[model samples]
Target: MHIVYPAVVSALLFSIGVYGVLARRNTILVLMSVELMLNAVNLNLVAFDVWLRDRLHAGQVLTLFVIVIAAAEVGLGLAIILALYRNRRTVDLDRLRLLAETPAPTGSTSVPGAVSPPSSGPGEGP
Candidate 1:
């Protein structure tokens, strides 16, 4: 059980996760890739913790904290993805633009060099 073995495995997992996050188009798949990366980090933490023989088990404790954060991230990420799917009917990251402006409503005219006069309010007449 040499340290190199676990380190190599962690590196491979992280590489794969990075590929998934970069190459995948689906939002859910991207989230899963991020989780994979986090798990790889946890593996590294435990491996180093055991290798160092720390009395405080700081590696394991930190791994636990990372797991907790990962869980929370998954929960919130899934909720957002679900909401986007419900509204947009697709989770393709390229097509999903939350801040993109929508087209104007139908029957609206915008002509060049066209100016309309302003109307007066109840208390402010022209």
Candidate 2:
């Protein structure tokens, strides 16, 4: 096979990955996109290694390293996503913005100079 075949495939994979990362809102999908990008890089690495017919096969070796790092990244990334889902229910990236303004509280109209009642929790003085 010609080198162009794998090279073109790798380029397509990378473009798809970039599109996914840019367009997707769900956290899991974003992570998957990042994985896709990494896989594309791995494909390029191995394809070039074969095309060059290198005795050291350094590209292939680096591809292995990338796979290992990607695995570790996925593990940690999923763990964080799971924790976030537990806390926030939805995994939408826009909704998860840390700096977003908080919505105002509802339905408690206070009169001017009126004091709010205290909570009646346990161990509290009345």
- Among all candidates shown, the one with the greatest TM-score: 1
TM-score, cand. 2: 0.76
Regions more than 4 Å wrong, model 1: 102-126
- For residue 33, model 1's alpha carbon misses the true position, in angstroms, by 0.8
lDDT accuracy of residue 49 in candidate 1:
99
lDDT of 2: 0.79
lDDT of 2 at 5: 93
lDDT tens digits, residue span 60-116, model 1: 999999999999999999988875655555789887554643454674432111122
> What is the alpha-carbon lDDT of model 1 when measured against the actual structure?
0.80
Residue-pair clashes per prediction, in order, are: 0, 0
| Candidate 1 TM-score, true structure as reference | 0.78
Pairs with backbone N, CA or C atoms under 3 Å apart (clashes), candidate 1: none
